[model samples]
Target: MVTLMRKQFIIAVIVAALLAIAVTFGVKYAQQGPTLGGDFTLTYRAESFHFAEKAKPLNILYIGYAKCPDVCPMALSHTAQAIKEASEKERSKVQMIFISVDAANDTADAVATYAEQFNPAFIGLTGTKDQIDAAIKLFGASYMIEENKKSYLGYSIAHTDRLYFLDKKGRVRDMISSPRSSEEILQKIKELL
Candidate 1:
Protein backbone atom coordinates (compact mmCIF):
# COMPACT_ATOMS: atom_id res chain seq x y z
CA MET A 1 0.00 0.00 0.00
CA VAL A 2 2.80 2.45 0.86
CA THR A 3 4.55 1.76 -2.44
CA LEU A 4 1.34 2.32 -4.35
CA MET A 5 0.75 5.61 -2.60
CA ARG A 6 4.28 6.78 -3.42
CA LYS A 7 3.84 5.90 -7.09
CA GLN A 8 0.51 7.78 -7.18
CA PHE A 9 2.09 10.87 -5.65
CA ILE A 10 4.86 10.80 -8.24
CA ILE A 11 2.37 10.50 -11.06
CA ALA A 12 0.32 13.36 -9.68
CA VAL A 13 3.38 15.59 -9.51
CA ILE A 14 4.33 14.70 -13.07
CA VAL A 15 0.80 15.52 -14.29
CA ALA A 16 0.81 18.83 -12.48
CA ALA A 17 4.14 19.80 -13.98
CA LEU A 18 2.90 18.94 -17.47
CA LEU A 19 -0.25 20.97 -16.93
CA ALA A 20 1.80 23.95 -15.75
CA ILE A 21 3.99 23.83 -18.86
CA ALA A 22 0.92 23.69 -21.13
CA VAL A 23 -0.66 26.68 -19.41
CA THR A 24 2.54 28.69 -19.74
CA PHE A 25 2.76 27.98 -23.46
CA GLY A 26 -0.91 28.82 -23.97
CA VAL A 27 -0.50 32.18 -22.29
CA LYS A 28 2.58 32.97 -24.33
CA TYR A 29 0.78 32.11 -27.55
CA ALA A 30 -2.05 34.47 -26.67
CA GLN A 31 0.28 37.28 -25.68
CA GLN A 32 2.00 37.04 -29.04
CA GLY A 33 -1.40 37.39 -30.75
CA PRO A 34 -2.67 35.16 -33.52
CA THR A 35 -0.34 34.28 -36.39
CA LEU A 36 -3.14 34.27 -38.94
CA GLY A 37 -4.44 36.51 -41.75
CA GLY A 38 -3.08 36.78 -45.30
CA ASP A 39 -4.00 37.74 -48.81
CA PHE A 40 -6.17 35.53 -51.01
CA THR A 41 -7.30 35.54 -54.64
CA LEU A 42 -10.89 35.63 -55.86
CA THR A 43 -13.03 36.89 -58.72
CA TYR A 44 -13.45 40.66 -58.91
CA ARG A 45 -15.33 42.28 -61.77
CA ALA A 46 -15.47 38.91 -63.54
CA GLU A 47 -11.69 38.79 -63.51
CA SER A 48 -9.12 37.17 -61.26
CA PHE A 49 -8.16 39.52 -58.45
CA HIS A 50 -4.92 38.70 -56.71
CA PHE A 51 -5.23 40.53 -53.46
CA ALA A 52 -1.54 41.06 -52.88
CA GLU A 53 -1.04 42.38 -56.35
CA LYS A 54 -4.13 44.53 -56.78
CA ALA A 55 -5.01 45.77 -53.31
CA LYS A 56 -4.08 49.25 -52.20
CA PRO A 57 -1.61 50.08 -49.47
CA LEU A 58 -4.39 49.68 -46.89
CA ASN A 59 -7.44 47.45 -47.19
CA ILE A 60 -10.60 46.83 -45.19
CA LEU A 61 -12.07 43.42 -45.84
CA TYR A 62 -15.48 42.01 -44.89
CA ILE A 63 -17.11 38.67 -45.54
CA GLY A 64 -20.88 38.57 -46.09
CA TYR A 65 -23.62 38.19 -48.66
CA ALA A 66 -25.10 40.96 -50.78
CA LYS A 67 -28.68 40.10 -49.87
CA CYS A 68 -28.04 40.36 -46.18
CA PRO A 69 -30.72 42.47 -44.57
CA ASP A 70 -29.15 44.15 -41.55
CA VAL A 71 -25.66 43.26 -40.41
CA CYS A 72 -23.94 43.45 -43.79
CA PRO A 73 -25.44 46.78 -44.78
CA MET A 74 -24.69 48.29 -41.41
CA ALA A 75 -21.09 47.18 -41.58
CA LEU A 76 -20.66 48.47 -45.10
CA SER A 77 -22.32 51.78 -44.32
CA HIS A 78 -20.07 52.31 -41.34
CA THR A 79 -17.02 51.54 -43.44
CA ALA A 80 -18.17 53.80 -46.27
CA GLN A 81 -18.72 56.63 -43.85
CA ALA A 82 -15.22 56.18 -42.60
CA ILE A 83 -13.77 56.24 -46.12
CA LYS A 84 -15.73 59.33 -46.99
CA GLU A 85 -14.45 61.06 -43.89
CA ALA A 86 -10.84 60.39 -44.74
CA SER A 87 -8.77 62.90 -46.70
CA GLU A 88 -8.34 62.26 -50.39
CA LYS A 89 -4.69 61.39 -49.79
CA GLU A 90 -5.69 58.79 -47.20
CA ARG A 91 -8.54 57.50 -49.35
CA SER A 92 -6.23 57.10 -52.31
CA LYS A 93 -4.12 54.62 -50.36
CA VAL A 94 -7.01 52.57 -48.95
CA GLN A 95 -9.56 50.20 -50.48
CA MET A 96 -12.46 48.08 -49.26
CA ILE A 97 -13.00 44.47 -50.20
CA PHE A 98 -16.44 42.84 -50.02
CA ILE A 99 -16.34 39.08 -50.27
CA SER A 100 -19.68 37.29 -50.64
CA VAL A 101 -19.98 34.08 -48.66
CA ASP A 102 -23.34 33.15 -50.14
CA ALA A 103 -22.28 31.81 -53.52
CA ALA A 104 -25.56 30.05 -54.17
CA ASN A 105 -27.40 33.34 -54.60
CA ASP A 106 -24.67 35.99 -54.87
CA THR A 107 -23.32 36.12 -58.37
CA ALA A 108 -20.25 38.23 -59.11
CA ASP A 109 -22.44 40.87 -60.72
CA ALA A 110 -24.84 40.93 -57.80
CA VAL A 111 -22.04 41.41 -55.29
CA ALA A 112 -20.45 44.10 -57.44
CA THR A 113 -23.69 46.07 -57.65
CA TYR A 114 -24.33 45.83 -53.96
CA ALA A 115 -20.77 46.70 -52.99
CA GLU A 116 -20.63 49.63 -55.39
CA GLN A 117 -23.79 51.05 -53.85
CA PHE A 118 -21.92 51.77 -50.66
CA ASN A 119 -18.75 53.10 -52.34
CA PRO A 120 -18.00 53.04 -56.02
CA ALA A 121 -14.41 52.03 -55.40
CA PHE A 122 -15.27 49.13 -53.10
CA ILE A 123 -14.23 45.82 -54.68
CA GLY A 124 -16.71 42.94 -54.53
CA LEU A 125 -15.51 39.36 -54.90
CA THR A 126 -16.82 35.78 -54.83
CA GLY A 127 -15.74 32.43 -56.17
CA THR A 128 -16.31 28.68 -56.05
CA LYS A 129 -16.84 26.89 -52.77
CA ASP A 130 -13.21 25.84 -52.58
CA GLN A 131 -11.91 29.30 -53.42
CA ILE A 132 -14.10 30.97 -50.84
CA ASP A 133 -13.28 28.38 -48.23
CA ALA A 134 -9.58 28.93 -48.75
CA ALA A 135 -9.97 32.70 -48.50
CA ILE A 136 -12.15 32.41 -45.40
CA LYS A 137 -9.60 30.16 -43.77
CA LEU A 138 -6.90 32.76 -44.34
CA PHE A 139 -8.88 35.35 -42.38
CA GLY A 140 -10.39 33.02 -39.73
CA ALA A 141 -13.89 34.00 -40.89
CA SER A 142 -16.85 31.72 -41.34
CA TYR A 143 -20.42 31.66 -42.65
CA MET A 144 -23.30 29.26 -43.09
CA ILE A 145 -26.39 29.50 -45.26
CA GLU A 146 -29.57 28.31 -43.59
CA GLU A 147 -32.87 27.48 -45.16
CA ASN A 148 -35.73 29.70 -44.01
CA LYS A 149 -38.69 28.85 -46.17
CA LYS A 150 -40.95 30.90 -43.97
CA SER A 151 -38.98 34.08 -44.73
CA TYR A 152 -39.29 36.08 -47.92
CA LEU A 153 -35.75 35.30 -49.04
CA GLY A 154 -36.25 31.56 -48.50
CA TYR A 155 -32.89 31.42 -46.76
CA SER A 156 -30.49 33.30 -44.53
CA ILE A 157 -26.80 33.46 -43.87
CA ALA A 158 -25.14 33.57 -40.49
CA HIS A 159 -21.62 35.00 -40.76
CA THR A 160 -19.00 36.80 -38.76
CA ASP A 161 -19.37 40.59 -38.58
CA ARG A 162 -15.78 41.74 -38.66
CA LEU A 163 -13.65 44.12 -40.66
CA TYR A 164 -10.10 42.95 -41.23
CA PHE A 165 -7.63 45.80 -41.45
CA LEU A 166 -4.68 45.04 -43.73
CA ASP A 167 -1.51 46.98 -44.12
CA LYS A 168 0.47 47.87 -47.23
CA LYS A 169 1.92 44.39 -47.57
CA GLY A 170 -1.49 42.75 -47.44
CA ARG A 171 -0.98 41.60 -43.88
CA VAL A 172 -3.71 41.83 -41.28
CA ARG A 173 -2.66 44.43 -38.76
CA ASP A 174 -5.91 44.68 -36.78
CA MET A 175 -9.59 43.80 -36.80
CA ILE A 176 -12.40 46.21 -36.08
CA SER A 177 -15.15 43.99 -34.74
CA SER A 178 -17.64 46.75 -33.85
CA PRO A 179 -16.77 50.35 -34.38
CA ARG A 180 -19.01 52.83 -32.51
CA SER A 181 -18.68 55.25 -35.41
CA SER A 182 -16.81 55.85 -38.64
CA GLU A 183 -14.37 58.00 -36.73
CA GLU A 184 -13.24 54.98 -34.75
CA ILE A 185 -12.59 53.07 -37.96
CA LEU A 186 -10.90 56.02 -39.58
CA GLN A 187 -8.62 56.37 -36.59
CA LYS A 188 -7.46 52.81 -36.95
CA ILE A 189 -6.99 53.24 -40.68
CA LYS A 190 -4.93 56.36 -40.19
CA GLU A 191 -2.75 54.68 -37.62
CA LEU A 192 -2.07 51.68 -39.83
CA LEU A 193 -1.53 53.75 -42.93
Candidate 2:
Protein backbone atom coordinates (compact mmCIF):
# COMPACT_ATOMS: atom_id res chain seq x y z
CA MET A 1 0.00 0.00 0.00
CA VAL A 2 2.85 2.38 0.82
CA THR A 3 4.60 1.46 -2.43
CA LEU A 4 1.44 2.29 -4.42
CA MET A 5 1.13 5.72 -2.74
CA ARG A 6 4.84 6.44 -3.32
CA LYS A 7 4.53 5.53 -7.04
CA GLN A 8 1.51 7.84 -7.38
CA PHE A 9 3.44 10.67 -5.76
CA ILE A 10 6.36 10.12 -8.10
CA ILE A 11 4.02 10.16 -11.12
CA ALA A 12 2.47 13.42 -9.93
CA VAL A 13 5.92 14.95 -9.50
CA ILE A 14 6.91 13.93 -13.04
CA VAL A 15 3.70 15.37 -14.46
CA ALA A 16 4.27 18.62 -12.63
CA ALA A 17 7.83 18.81 -13.95
CA LEU A 18 6.61 18.25 -17.53
CA LEU A 19 3.98 20.95 -17.15
CA ALA A 20 6.58 23.39 -15.84
CA ILE A 21 8.85 22.70 -18.78
CA ALA A 22 5.95 23.28 -21.21
CA VAL A 23 5.09 26.59 -19.57
CA THR A 24 8.69 27.72 -19.74
CA PHE A 25 8.92 27.00 -23.47
CA GLY A 26 5.56 28.66 -24.08
CA VAL A 27 6.68 31.83 -22.39
CA LYS A 28 9.94 31.82 -24.34
CA TYR A 29 8.06 31.44 -27.61
CA ALA A 30 5.73 34.28 -26.72
CA GLN A 31 8.70 36.50 -25.97
CA GLN A 32 10.49 35.66 -29.26
CA GLY A 33 8.01 36.88 -31.98
CA PRO A 34 7.67 35.29 -35.41
CA THR A 35 10.25 32.78 -36.68
CA LEU A 36 11.36 31.26 -40.03
CA GLY A 37 11.84 34.57 -41.88
CA GLY A 38 15.33 33.81 -43.17
CA ASP A 39 14.37 30.47 -44.67
CA PHE A 40 11.13 31.60 -46.31
CA THR A 41 11.32 32.28 -50.04
CA LEU A 42 8.67 33.55 -52.45
CA THR A 43 8.65 34.59 -56.09
CA TYR A 44 9.52 38.20 -56.88
CA ARG A 45 10.19 39.52 -60.41
CA ALA A 46 10.03 35.94 -61.71
CA GLU A 47 12.87 34.97 -59.38
CA SER A 48 13.01 33.38 -55.98
CA PHE A 49 13.25 36.21 -53.45
CA HIS A 50 14.66 35.80 -50.00
CA PHE A 51 15.69 38.38 -47.46
CA ALA A 52 19.05 40.06 -48.02
CA GLU A 53 19.49 40.79 -44.36
CA LYS A 54 22.48 43.13 -44.60
CA ALA A 55 21.42 44.69 -47.88
CA LYS A 56 17.91 45.74 -46.89
CA PRO A 57 18.61 45.85 -43.13
CA LEU A 58 14.88 46.20 -42.52
CA ASN A 59 11.74 44.87 -44.15
CA ILE A 60 8.12 45.89 -43.78
CA LEU A 61 5.88 43.03 -44.86
CA TYR A 62 2.18 43.29 -45.71
CA ILE A 63 0.02 40.28 -46.53
CA GLY A 64 -3.05 40.67 -48.72
CA TYR A 65 -4.25 40.16 -52.26
CA ALA A 66 -3.60 42.38 -55.25
CA LYS A 67 -7.30 42.32 -55.98
CA CYS A 68 -8.18 43.64 -52.57
CA PRO A 69 -10.27 46.70 -53.32
CA ASP A 70 -10.09 48.56 -50.05
CA VAL A 71 -7.74 47.43 -47.29
CA CYS A 72 -4.60 46.54 -49.26
CA PRO A 73 -4.47 49.69 -51.37
CA MET A 74 -4.94 52.03 -48.41
CA ALA A 75 -2.48 50.24 -46.17
CA LEU A 76 0.13 50.07 -48.91
CA SER A 77 -0.40 53.72 -49.75
CA HIS A 78 0.03 54.59 -46.10
CA THR A 79 3.21 52.51 -46.01
CA ALA A 80 4.50 54.28 -49.13
CA GLN A 81 3.82 57.68 -47.61
CA ALA A 82 5.70 56.65 -44.51
CA ILE A 83 8.64 55.49 -46.58
CA LYS A 84 8.56 58.65 -48.62
CA GLU A 85 8.65 60.62 -45.41
CA ALA A 86 11.81 58.82 -44.30
CA SER A 87 15.27 60.13 -45.03
CA GLU A 88 17.00 58.78 -48.13
CA LYS A 89 19.41 56.83 -45.94
CA GLU A 90 16.57 55.34 -43.97
CA ARG A 91 14.64 54.49 -47.16
CA SER A 92 17.63 52.80 -48.75
CA LYS A 93 18.09 50.54 -45.77
CA VAL A 94 14.51 49.31 -45.94
CA GLN A 95 12.46 47.22 -48.37
CA MET A 96 8.69 46.96 -48.44
CA ILE A 97 7.36 43.53 -49.37
CA PHE A 98 3.81 42.66 -50.30
CA ILE A 99 2.97 38.99 -50.17
CA SER A 100 -0.20 37.98 -51.96
CA VAL A 101 -2.31 35.56 -50.02
CA ASP A 102 -4.37 34.88 -53.15
CA ALA A 103 -1.83 32.53 -54.67
CA ALA A 104 -4.29 31.25 -57.24
CA ASN A 105 -4.85 34.63 -58.90
CA ASP A 106 -2.12 37.07 -57.92
CA THR A 107 0.82 36.13 -60.14
CA ALA A 108 4.31 37.34 -59.36
CA ASP A 109 4.28 40.00 -62.04
CA ALA A 110 0.77 41.09 -61.17
CA VAL A 111 1.69 41.46 -57.53
CA ALA A 112 4.80 43.40 -58.50
CA THR A 113 2.78 45.84 -60.58
CA TYR A 114 0.28 46.25 -57.79
CA ALA A 115 2.98 47.22 -55.34
CA GLU A 116 4.89 49.53 -57.70
CA GLN A 117 1.85 51.68 -58.23
CA PHE A 118 2.25 52.89 -54.64
CA ASN A 119 6.07 53.11 -54.59
CA PRO A 120 8.68 52.18 -57.17
CA ALA A 121 10.93 50.90 -54.40
CA PHE A 122 8.29 48.54 -53.11
CA ILE A 123 8.48 44.82 -53.91
CA GLY A 124 5.71 42.28 -54.30
CA LEU A 125 5.78 38.52 -54.01
CA THR A 126 3.60 35.47 -54.60
CA GLY A 127 4.12 31.73 -54.76
CA THR A 128 2.41 28.41 -55.00
CA LYS A 129 -0.21 27.50 -52.41
CA ASP A 130 2.30 25.55 -50.35
CA GLN A 131 4.94 28.27 -50.50
CA ILE A 132 2.49 31.01 -49.52
CA ASP A 133 1.19 28.84 -46.71
CA ALA A 134 4.74 28.37 -45.42
CA ALA A 135 5.28 32.12 -45.40
CA ILE A 136 1.94 32.69 -43.69
CA LYS A 137 2.94 30.24 -40.98
CA LEU A 138 6.45 31.70 -40.79
CA PHE A 139 5.07 35.15 -39.99
CA GLY A 140 2.26 33.91 -37.76
CA ALA A 141 -0.26 35.51 -40.18
CA SER A 142 -3.57 33.97 -41.12
CA TYR A 143 -5.86 34.26 -44.14
CA MET A 144 -9.00 32.69 -45.47
CA ILE A 145 -10.16 32.82 -49.11
CA GLU A 146 -13.87 32.85 -49.53
CA GLU A 147 -15.82 32.78 -52.78
CA ASN A 148 -18.59 35.30 -53.21
CA LYS A 149 -20.81 34.65 -56.20
CA LYS A 150 -22.57 37.93 -55.73
CA SER A 151 -19.39 39.95 -55.54
CA TYR A 152 -17.60 41.42 -58.52
CA LEU A 153 -14.27 39.76 -57.75
CA GLY A 154 -15.84 36.31 -57.36
CA TYR A 155 -13.68 35.70 -54.27
CA SER A 156 -12.15 37.68 -51.47
CA ILE A 157 -9.47 36.90 -48.97
CA ALA A 158 -9.87 37.81 -45.34
CA HIS A 159 -6.26 38.16 -44.33
CA THR A 160 -4.24 39.56 -41.45
CA ASP A 161 -4.15 43.34 -41.79
CA ARG A 162 -0.99 43.78 -39.75
CA LEU A 163 2.30 45.02 -41.10
CA TYR A 164 5.12 42.78 -39.91
CA PHE A 165 8.46 44.42 -39.30
CA LEU A 166 11.61 42.34 -39.77
CA ASP A 167 14.90 43.54 -38.47
CA LYS A 168 18.38 43.25 -39.99
CA LYS A 169 18.51 39.58 -39.06
CA GLY A 170 15.19 38.93 -40.86
CA ARG A 171 13.38 38.19 -37.63
CA VAL A 172 9.94 39.71 -37.11
CA ARG A 173 10.36 42.35 -34.43
CA ASP A 174 6.94 44.00 -34.49
CA MET A 175 3.49 43.97 -36.08
CA ILE A 176 0.85 46.70 -36.31
CA SER A 177 -2.63 46.49 -37.72
CA SER A 178 -4.31 48.73 -40.28
CA PRO A 179 -6.27 51.97 -39.81
CA ARG A 180 -2.88 53.14 -38.57
CA SER A 181 -1.87 56.59 -39.78
CA SER A 182 1.14 57.39 -41.96
CA GLU A 183 2.68 59.21 -39.04
CA GLU A 184 2.24 56.15 -36.87
CA ILE A 185 3.91 53.96 -39.48
CA LEU A 186 6.70 56.42 -40.00
CA GLN A 187 7.24 56.54 -36.26
CA LYS A 188 7.56 52.76 -36.17
CA ILE A 189 9.94 52.90 -39.11
CA LYS A 190 12.13 55.45 -37.41
CA GLU A 191 12.06 53.46 -34.21
CA LEU A 192 13.14 50.30 -36.04
CA LEU A 193 15.79 52.16 -38.00
**What is the lDDT, from 0 to 100, of the residue 20 in candidate 1?**
100
Please state the error at residue 156 of candidate 1 in Å.
0.4
Question: What is the C-alpha local distance difference test score of candidate 2?
Answer: 0.86
RMSD of 2: 4.8
Candidate 2 segments whose C-alpha is farther than 4 A from its true place: 1-36, 52-55
Pairs that collide, model 2: none
By lDDT, the best candidate is: 1
Q: Which candidate is the best by TM-score?
A: 1
The residue pairs found clashing in candidate 1 are none
Residue 10's lDDT within candidate 2 is 100
Q: Which digits, one per residue and each the tens of the lDDT, describe model 2 over residues 72-157?
A: 99899999999999999989878898999888888899999999999998999999999999987877789998988877999878
Task: Assess the local accuracy of residue 153 in candidate 2 as a C-alpha lDDT between 0 and 100.
Answer: 91
Cα displacement (Å) at residue 35, model 1: 1.8
Count clashing pairs, candidate 1.
Answer: 0
